[model samples]
Target: MNWHGLKAIYLHEMDRMRRTLFQSLVSPFISTSLYFVVFGSAIGSRITEIEGISYGSFIVPGMIMLTVLTQSISNASFGIFFPKFTNTVYELLAAPLSTFEIILGFVGAAATKSLIIGTVIILTAGIFVDLHIEHPFIMMFFLVLTCVTFSLFGFLIGIWADNFEKLQVIPILVITPLVFLGGSFYSINMLPEFWQKISLLNPVLYLVSGFRWSFYEIADVSILTSLITILFFLSACVLTIIYAFSKGYKIKN
Candidate 1:
């Protein structure tokens, strides 16, 4: 399994986080605080509750998911992309590590970082709102699954990217918008009946729906559908990563 090689790569990525502690950790924390301040103050005044949950509390899961999703991709993508950018990936490829070990190290560390950030944001959110977890186990399961799934997706982005700008493309142009529109800040029920059905087409809706369900026992979609959606994407990302490694796609370039 090349445990030593895996540990080395894992530690290297973790060390990078330590070096950029402010950007990697604190920045997200501050941004989340601002979201609470702006949204809780400006929006909370107008809408007190959604489905019996306070406006502030209602958005916690969505807020956490938003940060975790973007950060997971950014961290994992940059972790591998930097090595490729600097031509250090060939050295790692030539090392004793197997493909699985390499992926485990990078994706595992990225997931860990995102999880930590997500947890911290949760704790931070508690200070502003009264929080409850009807399904703590389910909440954690969704959290872990989201982190790991997106981390793998980020790994693919790392391999596919040829320049630094490409790294920001998906997260900015695609993911962020999906999250904002995906029942994150507000429930899809608030939308018109037709738009509610249209919201279902956005993949992030299922994710936020399921995650929010874990917290409040409420969701825009069925929990089963959300779980299935996550698992399907996770499997797809894993298979894509395998194919990329086998083909030596961007790695050998």
Candidate 2:
């Protein structure tokens, strides 16, 4: 299993995070806090509550998911991308580490960072609005699954990227928009009936839906659907990673 190699790589990534603590951690925290301030003050005025949950409280789950999703990808993608950028990946490939160990170390650390940020965001949200978890276990399960799954997805991004700019492409152009449009800030029910159906197609909706469900027991879709969606995404990311490694995509070269 190469436990020593795995531990070394894991510590290296964690150390890197510590070194860039502000950019890696505090930046997202500050940004999300602003969402509460601006959105809560502005939007909260127009929309007092959604499904009886206060506007600020209603957006808490979505806010956390938004941060966790983007941060997971950024953290994991940059963690591996930097090594590739510096031509240090070849050294990692030569080390006494199996592919599984390498992935576990990098992805695990990314997930851990996202999870910590998620918890902190939750606590920070509590100060703004009343926060309660009707289903703490389910809330945690979704949180962990989201972090790990997206971390794996980010790992693929890290491997696929050959340059620095490519790293921002998906998170900015794709992921961020998906979150904002995917019932993160507002319930899908508020949309017209036709648009509500369309919202179902956005993958992040299921995640935000189920996550919000854990807090208030209300969701745009069934909790089962959300669980299946994340699991399916997780499986797909795993398969894609295996294929990428087999073909040596952006790695062996």
Q: How does each model score on lDDT? A: 0.92, 0.92
Q: Write the per-residue lDDT of candidate 2 for residues 112-204, one digit (tens) a residue.
A: 999989988988888788799999999999999999999999999999898889999999999999999999999988999999989999999
**Number of the predicted model whose lDDT against the real structure is largest:** 1
| Backbone-clash count (model 2) | 0
The reply for model 1, stretches above 4 Å from the true place, is: none
When summed lDDT is taken over every stretch of 10 residues in candidate 1, the lowest stretch is 20-29
Cα lDDT tens digits, model 1, 178-201, are 999999999999999999998999
What is candidate 1's TM-score against the reference?
Answer: 0.98
Number of colliding residue pairs in each model? 0, 0
How does each model score on TM-score? 0.98, 0.97
